[model samples]
Target: MAICNQSQFKPISISPKTNHLSNFNLQISRSQTLLKCHNNNTSSLPTKTLKIEPLPLFTSVRSFAPATVANLGPGFDFLGCAVDGIGDYVTLNVDPEVQPGQISISDINGVGNSGKLSKNPLWNCAGIAAISVMRMLGVQSVGLSISLEKGLPLGSGLGSSAASAAAAAVAVNEMFGGVLSESELVLAGLESEAKVSGYHADNVAPAIMGGFVLIRSYDPLDIIQLRFPMEKELFFVLVNPDFEAPTKKMRAVLPSEIAMSDHIWNSSQAGSLVAAVLQGDLRGLGKALSSDRIVEPKRAPLIPGMGAVKNAAIGAGAFGCTISGAGPTAVAVTDNEQKGRDIGEKMVEAFWREGNLKATATVRSLDRVGARLISSNS
Candidate 1:
């Protein structure tokens, strides 16, 4: 999810520059019905659960959560998968001398934040998640110190904040004796994510649980976990351009409604993508991923060089390509790492030659192990 940077917001005022008619209409509609439409139907969906390893009970612990790619074309706000080799890390230490159930931030520095990230627990994603865990567990007198190490770039559409939230949730949970289940920890992480990103689970769920996760419903948090067959080999080529797409602005551009025909088309593609994941059908997955007629069409134009980079990827033998998370970071899938690297090169070149943007690409597989403890002092 593309988190709206807090600093990016300013006092609302009429601008001398006029919005295009289409945009003006969309924003008007969003403002009108955004609140009243969310009537919570009490009808409940069956809940799903996830289980994770308990770290050794210790006074201090460090946890790592992998980066994630959300949306997956048609599965907006639901489908996501943890990426290997890139993510955020959190370190927690028991501070008995401080007030009970209070979490203090010792440091938050990494990636490209340059000290811009908030140190306040309430404002920071990691801090918020950790504090939520404390409240959930009825923590009375345990003070924890947190240190964040960001390995993922901020707002790259790679679930940077979600990674931080997941790592913090895991770190805090383990530090407090591992009382929370995987599902509960995900819920804790979601609490923080909802404060920054829109209320969605696509990023936080996968970052906490790992694997490919389908959020069946947000009401009861029904997460249907799926995986590729062991025999099937797939890799994700993530190309992040030098750009930031704020979540608020990205969402503001979307239409509130779609034609029934378009709805059915996206539904079919979403189901096909799920089936592809189940059967290890990389080709099918790619087709479904690239065939989204809804969000991608609207979002592609917003990202510079997206169309040409996608074409370059497919022509270079990528199974399929689409925008990852929100924008600026386009993702492609393939069966071969070498092929993925080549695709990355093509996409990177397109970003420079076509979009005039410099970008970096990394090839990685899915991370089956989500957030986990690295070290702890028993």
Candidate 2:
């Protein structure tokens, strides 16, 4: 289904000077005076110029992007949170010998079917994102090889593709002297995600920016990084069933249009969720999360024993339970780490006993750090 439109909600104003990075340190922010001859009259005007700096020739660069959970129930594509412990790592190697503007996939590990992954840049998420980063920086030519180590399961509703894309974009941007801004890197990741799934930034935003992200608007690209409560301890339980919920298929099953009543309900829940998060009201946040009236209802039938699993989690003292992304994976929240573990195991057991599906569960705290460079070799 199409994500909820931001126009439906009241506009949320945010400052541009927030902690999020905007431009690379090397990128020129000053305007240069240029002389223009108009109608035989010389006129002096300021023009923007993107200054390119020569970067150190690095042999290899490695980066990591954390896994994320999008939708978060009521907010759909507008909301997302990063998960710790699981993510994707990408290593980019410059191949000056090869033709510029070409990217080759040298190796892929972690995710299954390595042979199935295309070597062509356009077909690969990491390669495409890296190439997009190069294009964004006005780099006409670049030749590189990429290696992916997928830590998250494919189609696990864990933002696997986004992690790969974010890691690749960050690595490529870093290798090129970090010219792209944080938002620009998200755009690069979106380019890759568009090719793989649909063009949406819910997963990409949090994967690159960390914490909780509210995609206020797609046009003009307004992304707000919500402050997560560091004072309050929060835990998450992620249960992955032995089945893939391909995004395309899940989207296809959703209704093309939602009722106005449902829209209003969802918008209310979404607003409440944002407020609860900011106020550190875990109980209210959990209620808002489980109160989706639109997408989940339509999609729940696709997942076997989803109702039972959710019930088990809630019964086990989870704040709430909901499907993560386009799920076959379900996520639950809790304040206590031990309770979170119990919820996770209970959810997994429900999937197996009730749904007759084998699954695994993990308990993780939120990852505040998004994507970053791990190591680089010159």
Candidate 3:
């Protein structure tokens, strides 16, 4: 949904000063309450025994797509949501005779074949999903292969890689007679998250399953999937500065101990944002989205003219503007595409005027549909 309305909204209070990060030990206690919320609900169906009837050992190709956003506003590593516009598609095929634990990249095309996926297990979303699927099913000798069609930009904070992991997991599960439950797949995606940036599923979970998801805790796999209220139009103007910020570097820059006051401020803002979305208060939602007190300030400086771009977007009637992902890329939310386009133009103009650099911005509607299985071929 559009985070802000073009004419009706204005940025209320914004601090342009760079945040002074404190170096201290910050231990975020895992809250299993998030998980309990999902499992304890009476509406949820009880786990059913698998009615396995093996038809054939032949190969079947399936596709899965996931929406993702890491470092969503105040939560940093903890908060992420799957937007509709961007994601990854994975086509998986199972070959029973190929032996279990065997994975071959028969034909790697498009987004993930830069040899980067081959380097580290974490960076390769496909690899992580494969590992998780195998581990979960206790399969040791089934051969498999995956093809990825990546629609999202890599390193744009769009959960491009996480989409691959979610897609691969879903596709693999379907190929295996849907043995892995939805929760199991979510857990698998979270496990794969460790390959890239520690372990978290704020992005992957929602990407696998549509709608707004709250990751209350990661350990013991506590994932809460909540349905976002309908009647909201969440549009995204994703502006890529074509600059890359390492996720690890951004993590390192985070303040270990935030002031209790700042923490409260962020908490209120987050809560308000959530409420705004639920209430279908587009104006309020926009205001809340831009009112991030935690990471944006500390991280904006890394993007050359982020400050100017943000100001320009605000000037151009954007609800709020902030860096997308770790940035170089930024986002401006508006009620309509035209406003988003105008804001994007202003953002690029601001970058040029202030940083003497060129930037690109693409506008899209918020994707309510997370990931889906496109096809299965025998």
Give the candidate number with the greatest TM-score: 2
Error of 1 at 239 (Å): 0.2
lDDT of 2 by residue, 18-126 (tens): 3323233324232111111112111322233222432434679999999999999998988998988789999998888657756777888886434456667788888
The parts of candidate 2 lying over 4 Å away from their true place are: 1-22, 25-57, 112-115, 140-142
Best candidate (score: lDDT): 1
lDDT of 3 by residue, 226-339 (tens): 445666676777777756677778767778899999999989887776676567676776687677888899888877888898889889988867766666577777888888
- The residue-level lDDT of candidate 1 at 249 comes to 74
In angstroms, give how far residue 58 of model 1 lies from its true place. 1.4
Indicate the residue-level lDDT of 179 in model 1. 53
lDDT of model 2 at residue 325? 94
Error of 3 at 173 (Å): 1.1
Order of candidate numbers by lDDT, starting with the best = 1, 2, 3
lDDT of each: 0.81, 0.79, 0.64
Order the candidate numbers by TM-score, best to worst: 2, 1, 3
